[model samples]
Target: MDKLIKGALQFMQEGFNEHKNLFENLKEEQNPHTLFVGCADSRVLPNLITSTLPGELFVVRNIANIIPPYRIKDEYLASTAAIEYALYALKVQNVVICGHSNCGGCKDINQEKAKLLPNVSKWVSQLDEIKQQVDFTLELNHYEGQHGLRSWMIEKANIINSYNNLLTYPNVRQMVEEKKLSIKAWYFLIQTGEIFEYCEENGHFMPLGEKK
Candidate 1:
């Protein structure tokens, strides 16, 4: 906690001074262009990876970057509410769901470890559908002993599932249909710091800058 406080103080002194104009301009409002749904992993820095500034991304971080399928209930819907605000109020033009390699959340989903944490278990229940898909793929590919490949596929599959869940929102669907919104899924290679963007027509994620 002390280290975090020190960093906050340092930011207010040196870091904030550097971006004073940008902060001042955003004092009253923010118009982030993208809603970045990413993992709560300490290692995955969304802004750093994307070369984006503070106000450029309205970030939603969770166990596995999980965005619940849009639904209404008596319970609080934190993820859904954030998405709604980003789309309706902030009017973000793009939604980026980023899943990283070696994600602990993905590993937990596969291993059924999230059950230990009651809230996390409920939250990550959304991954069960895709988790089964991964198991089926592993069975067909015989990747049982290949832990790395298993995790790699699960992480990417989780990202694609998040994109699918995001569409469950009526507003989001309407926005996409009208071309007012764009949704993208990304796989981040933690070891190499490379990002692959999903191409729906091509049916897979390709290197970020390579032309199809």
Candidate 2:
């Protein structure tokens, strides 16, 4: 807490002073170009990772960076609501679903750890589809460790799954079909600080540098 306060003070004094004009402009309103949906993990800093300024990317972070499917009944759903606001309200041009290697939420799904956390149990249960995928893969060929490669695959798969879920929103689907909005799946290799962008052309994730 003390460290965070000190950092805020430093930012107010030094950082804010340096970017006074940017901050002043943002004080009136914000027009971010991208909507970044990423993990709540401290390791993933969306702005720092993308080298974006304060008004460049509107971000939504949650456990495993999950984007629940579009459901009208669930009016106050956090992620879904954020996606709607970013697309229809904020008018962001791009939506990026980012997942990282060795995600705890993915690990929990594989190890049945969510059962211990009642509230989180239902939330992370969204990964059940991926869990089934991993189980089917393991049944064909079992792995060594408890999680091992299966967990990693689940993490990456969740990114694509969330991206698909994003399209379930009527507005999002319309925008995408009309070429008004685009979606991208991203995988961040935490250990190496390397990010991969999913390439729909080849159906594979290529390094950030080779995205073209």
Candidate 3:
């Protein structure tokens, strides 16, 4: 607890001091152009990864970067509410769904750990649909050399699946149809610091630089 407080104080004293103007302006308004949906993994810092400064991104993070299909209910749904605010209030033009390699959530899905975390298990059940959509026969080992191919595939699939689910939101759907918004799926390999973009044509994720 002391360490946490110390960290907070450090941020207030040093970090915030360095960027006082940015924070002050952000206090008045934020006009981030992108909605970043990413995993709650400690290592996957969206701002750092993108080299984005303060107030550049509207972010929504979850255990596995999951975006549940839109639903109208009285329940408190953090991710959905964030998405709505980003799309409707912020009017973000791009929504990026980013998943990372060696994700605990993806590993859990592969290991069938859902039975232990009942709520998480239930929430991740949506990923099962994505799993079914993947072709198990793909020889990832032959191509990617097998260090973390399976996990990478799972990570990529989750990003694509979440992006598809994002479209289920009425506001998102309407905005996208009007060319007011675009969606991108990305996989970040933490170990190698490589980022891949989902190639819809090839039905696989390829390194971003390899495209075109």
Give the Cα lDDT of each candidate.
0.86, 0.87, 0.82
What lDDT, from 0 to 1, does candidate 2 have?
Answer: 0.87
- Every model: Cα RMSD to truth: 2.0, 2.1, 3.4
**lDDT, residue 92, candidate 1:** 94
Error of 2 at 160 (Å): 0.7
Q: Please report how far candidate 2 places residue 107 from its true position, in Å.
A: 1.2
Order candidates by lDDT, high to low: 2, 1, 3
Worst 10 residues of 3 by lDDT: 138-147
Question: What TM-scores do the predictions have?
Answer: 0.92, 0.92, 0.84
Error of 1 at 148 (Å): 1.7
In the range 33-130, model 2's lDDT, one tens digit per residue, is 99999999999999988998889999999989999888877346888888888888899999889999888877663345545676677788899879
Model 1 weakest 10-residue run by lDDT: 107-116
lDDT by residue for model 1 (1-212), tens:
99999999999889999989999999999999999999999999999999999799999988899887788899888888998889888999999999998888877543456455778777777777777888888889877767788788878888888898899887778889899999989999899998899887877999988726
Error of 1 at 2 (Å): 3.0
Which regions in candidate 2 have their CA more than 4 angstroms from the true location?
Answer: 109-116, 142-146
TM-score of 1: 0.92
